[model samples]
Structures are given as structure tokens and as C-alpha cells.
Target: MIDRSDGQDEVAGIAVRIIKEGDRIADIVKNLLAFARDWKEEQGPALIQDILADSLGLVEKQILKDGIRFKTYISPDLPEIKARSQHIQQVFLNILSNARHALNQRFPGFHENKVLEIRSEVVEIEGRRYIRTTFYDRGVGIPGNIRDRICDPFFSSKPRGEGTGLGLSISHGITKDHSGRLWFDSVEGEYTKVMVDLPTVE
Candidate 1:
């Protein structure tokens, strides 16, 4: 038997992650095909739990590898929402990726305080019921001066080779298309919380 510290485990971990990523991409493709089939009709309702579970599965490895603590609170009784599940999953992926990047930027080495928390529940506003998923990250938060421009097209804090600055803009549009809302709040060095609200199905 080989010793665990010989980097064999690290190599295996990378292989596992690659396999998982491939599986996730295949799943995403299936969902996109389903969405295309129903393009002429209303996309339909998808359980918030299912969507979150899928999204989390895709990113959990990356989060763990980076030494970031990830936590979630998803209400068991939350109602399903009317929307394309794939699009919502994409939104979650994008933000999670951004959070991971921010945390890595702020704490290059293992940081005991790095945490990402996700909460999901049903909420009521003006007599309307909605499902909301809020993601909070203790990272180098968005600067106040550029907070308003964060979602604008072609705007990014990442270096040129790392990003195209279209993630948030596309996410914003997808949320709007589903009759939902995507917004965030942050303090430069404290934390950032992004909330996605989508109307629940009756």
C-alpha cells in the first residue's frame, strides 16, 4: 500500500473532480435539450431543492479544495417556482465561481475565516409568494464605487485572461426572463450576499 502523503491522493482527487465535472456537463446538456423541447411553451416549475442540490454537487469539490467552508439552509417545504431550471442553475454556478475567486484572491493560503453560506426559503412580498436563494461569502467584497456597475456588460474585476465580464450581465438577464430578481449587497472588505427571487407556482 502506498503512503497517502505521496501525492497519490491528490492525483486521485483531481481525477475524481474531472469525472464529476464531465458528469455535470452531461447533465447540463440534457437539461438544455429539455428546455429547447419546451421552448414554445412555458418552461414550467422546478423544485428549489432539486435545483440547489444539482448546483451544489457541481461546485462542492472546488469549494472544498480551496479550504472554504460551505454551508446551506434549504427549507424542506419551500414551494416550486416557475422557471427554467437550467438557467437558474447557471446563475448559481456563476456566482459560486465568483465567490471562490474572490476568496482565493483575499486569502491565498488556507484561511480559517473563509466561508460561503447559502440559504433558500419561501418568502412573501405584497401578497405574492416567491422562492429566494441567498448566497453570502466572506471575501473581498465589491468596492462601493463599482457596485452599481458590477452587473453591467463588459465589467469585471478579474484579470483579462480570467473573465469576459459577461457572467453577471447574462445572469441578470436570465433572472429577469424568469420573472425573478437578482441583486447583491457588499462591504469592500467584509462580505457579499446575493439574493435571487423567483415567483412561486400556485
Candidate 2:
């Protein structure tokens, strides 16, 4: 009877896991649909943390599958910003995608330092408050020669047919449209950090 009870408990654990996975997949589908729909030119107050959560939901599984450690440090009490949520989400998706690519290129296999870290905080720039979201990756950093052209249209270091070269360009434009700033800092063969600063709703 004891052995049978243990087997039943094991089955229950598996069932629970399956149910959780189903829920996650359903959430992913919902987020994807929201992401793919057309925007209606409506901008409103949005929580940056919520936008980041939705963006991560779209790519977190794949990043983990690639054996890169993902970490986040989001502060509580972050203020809302005036934004088109979908567009801001796109910018985050681009940054996360790039970070994943860079980590894969550098590691190609699991390593202790293969990591992606995202953090957020309220920052004051020019006496104005803004929420600064930063993505840092220990990956194949940007080369000096192409750093200046990284945001130029049709400029991609990726192999042929792999990239359209407009990800960063479009992200930059979107940030500007929202009165935000996007910039990058990197050291070749070491790491890359991308920061986006958007003003808080005053």
C-alpha cells in the first residue's frame, strides 16, 4: 500500500506540472496576440515593469533554453510613463533578442558567466525624473568599427539573410517618439549594456 501511495503522489506531481505548463502557454499566446495587433495611435500611462513582464513572457523560455542565465532587478514604486505600450514592448523585445544572439555567439554552450541582467530605477536627468531600464549581457560585445553605425538603417553585422538591420534603428525612433533616450555601452569580447530612459508622467 505504501508503494502504491508513492506512485500516486508522483502522478499528482506530474499532473500539476502539466497544468502549470498549459497555463504558461496560454499566457504566451495571449501576449503574442496583443503584440501582433495593430496600434490605434493611442498613448496612455503605462507601468514600465508591466511592459517588461509582457516582453519577457514572449522570450524568456527561449533564452533559458539557450542556457543563458536571466536575472532582473526591478525596483518597487516605479512611476508610470506616457507610452504606447506595444511600441515600448517592441523596443524591449529587440534588446532582449540582441542580447540572446550575442550570448549565443560568445558562448555557443553553457558557461558560468553567460548571463543577461535587466534592472530598473528612477533617475533624474537635467532635473527631470525618468525611469531608466537597462539590459546588460555578458556576450560578444559590439566591435568598435561598427559601433557608430549600429543604429543606421540596413546596417547589420549578422550574416546574410539572418538580420534586416533595422531593429535598433526602429527602436531608436520609437524611443524618440515617446520622448525617451536609448543608448549603448560595450566592450568588445566582454559585454554590452543598453539603456532606455523614458520620462515619468508628471
Candidate 3:
């Protein structure tokens, strides 16, 4: 037979249920708050491909017509690392467009020495393969003082009204979320090399 004090157990059960409900409600509230703070734009992998294609199509005419020699060196065996293809495209388009802008600002004429080169290769570190992409341009390079802060949000070396400064910051965030790295090397009055590393699943 059950003890008469069994009411205590029933009350405890109800208290436990209340605690669980409270926890669930708290979790929901926290998730809603997070949603309000972040801009989630994770498109499908195919969409990223479309973004890449779109960037290539959009910039094909300008890069070649600018009279600045262009070159691309991609490793044939490098696999497409898991990434938002469109964001990747945006990153590249931004860099390429930036390259042109820097070159134009350097000289009025696109001489033989004025050129841009893009290269990609696979780098393996700690049993992980990464696609290392580099964008190099013989253009007026960024000043040392400002180059380090290029990825800082809302920090731009461009003239006022010319930049929002979010491009590189967004690109950096995307790379980081995909377990990658973004970096650059530049020397004023010489050249600049922007390197991006994306971890490959395989």
C-alpha cells in the first residue's frame, strides 16, 4: 500500500514538469532573440554555384576590356569545398573589381606591366585539405597602416560614399564559418596578393 504522504511525490512530479516547461520556453525565447540578431543567408550549394557563374558572367566583359592582362591558375584536381557558392562568387567579384579599381587609380593607362593573376591550389595541413586561392595584381598596393584592418567591419580606405566596408568583413565571416582563412600581402606602390583558404571536405 502507498504511504499517505504520497501527495509529496505527486507535487514533486508537477514541479519537475514545470521546470522542464520553463526550460523549453526559455530556449525558445533565446532562439528568437538570436534570430533577430543574425542575418541568415545560407543558400543551398547549387545556389552558390549559380552565384559563382553569375559573378563570372557579370565580370567577364569588364576584366578583359580593361586592357589589364588577366590570368587564372586553378588546380585541376581541386574539389569544390563546401561553401555558399554565391558568397564565394561575391568575394571573388569584389576582389576582382577592387583589383581593377586599384589599377585604374594607379595609372591612366594599362601598360604591359599592369596585370592581375588568380591562382588556386590544394594545401594539406593536419590531415585536412584546403583550397588556397590567390588574387595578385600589379597595382598600387594598400598602405601598411590600413591593410591589416581591411576585414574590419565598416572600415574602408575608399573615399567617402564609395564604400560601405562590409564586403571584406562579410567575406571574412563567411570564410570563418566554413572553417577557412582570408589574408592579404601588400606593399605600397608595388603589388598586392589576396589569399583565401577554404577547407575541403575530402
Best-performing candidate as measured by lDDT: 2
TM-score of each candidate structure, all chains considered together:
0.79, 0.81, 0.73
Error of 2 at 7 (Å): 64
Descending-TM-score candidate ranking: 2, 1, 3
Worst 10 residues of 2 by lDDT: 31-40
lDDT of each: 0.85, 0.91, 0.75
The best-first sequence of candidates by lDDT reads 2, 1, 3
TM-score (C-alpha, index-matched) for candidate 1: 0.79
| Model 2 ranges off by over 4 Å | 1-40
Worst 10 residues of 3 by lDDT: 43-52
Per-model tally of clashing residue pairs: 0, 0, 2
Q: What tens digits encode model 1's per-residue C-alpha lDDT throughout 87-132?
A: 7888899899999988888888898778889999888988999988
Q: How well does candidate 3 match the true structure in TM-score terms?
A: 0.73
lDDT of 2 by residue, 1-202 (tens): 2469888999999999899767756765675566446456678999999999999999989999999897899999999999999899999998999999999999999999889999999999999999999999989999999999999976888875456677798789889989999999999999999999999999
Error of 2 at 161 (Å): 1.4
